[model samples]
Target chain A: MNINLTLIGQSITFAVFVWFCMKFIWPHIVHALDVRRKAIADGLAAAERGKHEQELAAKRATETLHDSKVKAAEIIAQAEKRAVQIIEEAKATAKAEGDRQLAAAQAEIEQAAHRAREQLRSQVAALVLAGAEKVLRREVDAKAHADLLEAISKEI
Target chain B: MAGEAHTSAEYIKHHLQNLVYGQHPDGTWGLAHSAAEAKAMGFWAIHLDTLGMSVLLGVVFLYFFRKAAIRATSGVPGGLQNFVEWVVEFIDGSVKGSFTGRNPLVAPLALTIFIWIFLLNLMDLVPIDWIPGLMGALGLPYFKLVPTTDPNATFGMAIGVFILILYYSVKMKGVGGFFGELAFQPFGKWGMPANLLLEGVNLIAKPVSLALRLFGNLYAGEMIFILIALMFSGGAVMFLTGGVLQWAWAVFHVLIITLQAFIFMTLTIVYLDMAHQEHH
Candidate 1:
């Protein structure tokens, strides 16, 4: 490798190329790389934020579900309680109506029994007074006989 | 200046010369540190043509990044943004694999190295002489296009890394401790002479390997491009074939450039990680 024009040209060219690369090319490359790195970091941060928001929403939904379930159970229990109360009231009202009708029927039966008993007693007294007069074989006054019959009936 | 020896070839040679001032031998690589002739110093100075193109590409990339940054969305990403993200993830994964946790400097440094070197390598894929030729047409002289192709530039980078690695190794393990590790390693508690020799070999090899690997790949690529350009200059048929070949080579070169940059960055991380480790 003698010292020649070609070698000299190559050397000078190499130097110039290097200077250019260092001054212009390398800096841009570095800047681009830096930008890329920052973009990735930003993406990761955004993803993390989104994940956190998703978790928070899930937690809130669970809380709301629990509250709603409790509310539903409370409403059902109240309805059941109201239904039981209405049934008890209807039973009590039916019992009271039945008692009133039974008392009225008993009173009517008693009054009918009393009237029948009075009629029977009167007929029996008349018959007993007739039998006594016949057995004595003598005619008696109607008022006296009626009094004797009444006394006999009372004794019987 | 316009003598018989100072023909067009001489003029070309004069302009092609590195810009070194006084107290420097002629027909040698120019040294900016020495006070040389202003013309010699300028020859070695920055080639503005390639610099402008490289900077233009960089500006374009910057614009792209800014646009992507401003329009970045969480829901869906565009194609360009996706590509950018993929590159970052790829580099991050490689770094993560190479370096252990809590290596605060490793990731950032590795990232910088990867991006910077990747951009440098990508420049090789550009029409190798396109920038320089354009500059020549525009009345500019001594325009070089590729940087890593230069040994000075590659060595400069490798040496910087070499220093950093040494600093870290010493820092992680105290002065006596670091030296002790080398002596005791590989040979294991053997004779002092054998240990010293082996350790010396091991120590010298690290920086040399790093520098040479990069230099070899870049220099070879630059040479091939120059040869191909010379071939195309010969004939029209050769010119068409050269263009086709250049395109194919560029496609293949994409892999080489990207892979080399990745390897370099990965190796750096690995070396730093190893230095921190208690054992090899």
Candidate 2:
């Protein structure tokens, strides 16, 4: 019941205990807590950044796909246009070739017709001469009958 | 065996007395003395039982906590680690809530006070006769096991807190501000004397209340246990009732012990917080 030196002794003990706790015990625990908190925060931020980058990558991927599709369509369109031009050129060439061949055949036919007409005319004249010779006697004067022959040829 | 011829009053008196070490009335130093002899030794004497028990419990507190602290990890904790973390978090939260200014020492100081006092008070739950009986067998007559039951121990702790409060007040507010706080108050500078007297009492009352609250609760609880033990002598029916009463009281005293420790710790933080604050 009496206040005594025990108070001082216990106070010293209390002070020592407090000093121990303050110096050794408190800092480590609090630092651990702070470290854990920081770790969680950093992890969350990294996850968020990863998600954002993933989204951006996805968007870029889609854009690239669209660009490739458009490029492929353009290439196909160019190929189709080139194919149409080739077909048109081929048609024009074939038409020109056919016309040239027709012209040549026409010329050949014309030449042949001319030759046949000439031959027909020569044969008719020869036949007429022979007929005249058969009708007239052989002693008639040939040089004097030249004008008659020429007239006859002209008549024929 | 000593109770064979003595009255119940003497038994209770014997149980309440501490194993004191002090000077004799003949001016000789001795190991043990009567309570009256301890009083006559005049504030120079020590209660060997209280000091021993308190220091032992303090060591127990330090050892267990230090072990837990060493093994403490940032990862998922084991049962002991979890318990230690929970206690640390609890005290840290209490200091944070009650203490406004930031001092690295406050949280740990609060933790030490709470746990150390809790350990000291827990000795009360030991069957009141167990240690004394054992020590009595070892030829030691008187021993008080619970340190907080002694006014000296509680006052000792409270006085330590009181010193911290004064230190913080002077450190934070300066010496002039500290005195100014005591000298000026609810009435104004015109009532400086009244303010000084009132605030001085208020300041003194903090530690006094802290000490007495714990000491009174535990001492009363110890007395009741002694009384209950005394009840065992009144035959079979009395002994049975006393047994039931002891069980009931022990159960109730658990809350008292823990609550008193918490109150003491909280008040310490609050007082320190008050010192840290500057009120113009």
Candidate 3:
């Protein structure tokens, strides 16, 4: 169509479009973009913080592990010390018991020896008296017999 | 135009020109077109075009950020709250570097300007004929959906920025100061006649360049698409070949649109910065 009126309308319409865009429309889109940018930066910051936290946690875990190992070592050392003390105490007690047993055995041996010796001496004396009784006759004169016996005994 | 092909090109170009004021008898442009109609329509939908998308996106962001911002704590941040803060800070940095003084209104305004323009520019990535063809199939005759492709739209924005720069210049540097800048800044102190001529040219060039940059890029993009369409409309062989070419170009065009939007936003900052500078 050869209509110029449409062109006129279009020109007016376009100018208004520009005005609307500059005044109102542009700000909103910019705000959205601005939001996008901020989101990216925040994400980076959060990631950094997370990394730091993780590093800290790892450090704490290592320290705790080291502490536990040291404590275990200390406990083992203490047990070893206690074991040595117990062994020393047991050794002392055994030595003392052996000494007491040796003393008791010696005392029993001495008593037995004394009893045997006495019995032997008694037996000997009885035998000698019996021999004298057999040799002498009954109802003899005591003084005469005694003097004879003494003289014979001195000569032999 | 002897060839049918040449006639078609002419036809398309004719159709693409703005419906400014009134036309000549032979469908050429008249000397004095109505500025009132041009002023009114040029700024209307262009404003709505940017505003509509901005508000929608803003509401979505606000809803999401509100939830995030509320949940924010000094302890640890995750999910959406972290995301929102990241975006806010990034844009804050960009604005800080580009804009000198902290005007509460200007920062947010610049942010809006960037994103809205970005979204608008992104629309170019869609297949040139896709929406129009779909609408046609749905019984709608024609659709010129791209906002930036319209010169009126780009110029309108440029003009708006131009006005603001002028206002700020006047405010920052008084009337004498504003005039003094054009007279002596570009060239050293010369006679009044030469100074006046140079100043007038410099003064007019700002809005012209701003408007033309956006217009030229978008217009060129639109023309390429129209050319591709013409190829397909001719025959089946041309259609298939042109279709492949169109797809390839569309993919490549994504970078163009994004770059254009970024350039426009950055330029806006630069221009505003210039206005704020103290004259030597």
For DockQ, the strongest prediction is 2
Candidate 1, after superposition: displacement of residue B225 in Å?
A: 2.0
Arranged by TM-score, best first: 2, 1, 3
Tell the DockQ for candidate 2. 0.50
Over B1-280, each residue of candidate 1 has an lDDT whose tens digit, in order, gives 2234445444334333332222223555433332234334433344333344435544555556456555555445689767656665676688778777455566545655566566776777766556655655775444455655545445545655666678888988888778887787666777667888887777667756765777678667766665565556547999898888887878887888777777777887787777776655
- Estimate, for each residue in A36-57, the C-alpha lDDT of model 3 and write its tens digit: 5688789999999999999999
For this target, which candidate reaches the highest TM-score against the unseen true structure? 2
Model 2 CAPRI rating: medium
TM-score preference between candidates 2 and 3, better one: 2
lDDT of 3 by residue, B89-163 (tens): 555666678888545545544554555455566667666657655644775333445656665556656666677
Error of 1 at A102 (Å): 6.4
- CA displacement after TM-score superposition, residue B160 of candidate 3 (Å): 1.3
Location of the lowest summed lDDT over 10 successive residues in candidate 3 chain B = B42-51
Worst 10 residues of 2 chain A by lDDT: A133-142
lDDT of 2 by residue, A1-156 (tens): 778899998999899999998887777777666666788899999999999999999999999999999999999999999999999999999999999999999999999999998788878888878788777648656788878888888777
For model 3, the superposed segments whose C-alpha errors exceed 4 Å read A1-96, A115-156, B1-14, B17-150, B170-180, B183-200, B217-260
**Candidate DockQ scores, in order:** 0.06, 0.50, 0.04
TM-score for chain A in each prediction: 0.47, 0.59, 0.54
